[model samples]
Target: MRKRERENPCGVCGHYHKYEEGEVCETCGHRMLATSEKASVHFSAFPSEILPQFLYLGSYDNASRSELLKTQGISRVLNTVPACQNLYKNSFTYHCLQDDKSLSFDDANQFLENCERDKARVLVHCMSGKSRSPAIVIAYLMKSKGWRLERSHQWVKERRPSIDLAEGTLVH
Candidate 1:
């Protein structure tokens, strides 16, 4: 077996064990290791004022307030939470999603793309401005701007410091 496999868990021990080639586990004397460990990459938060001028990332509270939207000259909203009320339904174009982690974002992506084509200033928000909204915004950046998932995530994070992306949501 390769060195990578040997560094994994030995199945008996819950934690990974270090063993040389042809060497048994120090704790259990087992030669095998669990291959269930998945690799993940972490991104750092950067300090930059490079937010897109026409796009806004905010929370439900920000969406609920008419004055906030008006003050920012927001012309549309992409709401990613299920059953989220369109507070200014008549005033702005609204696109609502159910906010499930497994939800496909094709429609949301199309809506944001349309907004971009029309040069519409839009506010994208979910319940807490954390998982769902950020995921959608990241998707928009990927689809519309031709950005990779990691770069899109970093760009959104730079603008919205409070965004907490859901696990496995940052797909290219």
Candidate 2:
């Protein structure tokens, strides 16, 4: 229903089109209209109420992890993976233990405290973006929202249908 973005140059690759018929980007293979639609709809994901100034990028998947970091407006990135801490430390703002299976509430609180102090928009990343990272996010939500851990997890699940907290992670 909408027209393609042949007129606008691609921001990612910076290539222009030759004519009105040319809707796709000239340089990159990406579709112009789709990119514009995504840009327009992205702000809807972060609602003003429950949405944290912080983001939870979640575990070690290449796509979600990279997208979270490369997102348009992000202030801080926290790589919660211990194994790859040294690799991404210089690139990111914080690198805490990636203790996914056994995430302690204290650690979550401490991380949130740091975020509050810095006034930064934090993105918590792990590997799969499912279990480990969601657990920490759940912990944070529970602490901040005063909801039971299970309820907090449910709330996040509503927004991110794919999320599944690691086993035994629901207990506070």
Among all candidates shown, the one with the greatest lDDT: 1
Which sections of candidate 1 miss by over 4 Å? 1-51, 98-101, 170-172
Off by over 4 Å in 2: 1-50, 62-70, 85-88, 98-101
Give a tens-digit lDDT track for model 2, residues 1-95: 23454556544334565323436543333333345544643322221222555554543333223344546345555555554333345445664
Candidate 1 structure quality by residue, lDDT tens digits, 6-101: 567543233355432335544333343234311222222221122455778776657767775776678888887665567677888898875455
What TM-score do all the candidates reach, one by one?
0.65, 0.56
Q: Flag clash pairs in model 2.
A: 58-126, 59-126, 59-127, 59-128, 59-129, 60-126, 60-127, 60-128, 61-127
Q: What is each predicted model's overall lDDT from 0 to 1?
A: 0.66, 0.53
Best model number under TM-score: 1
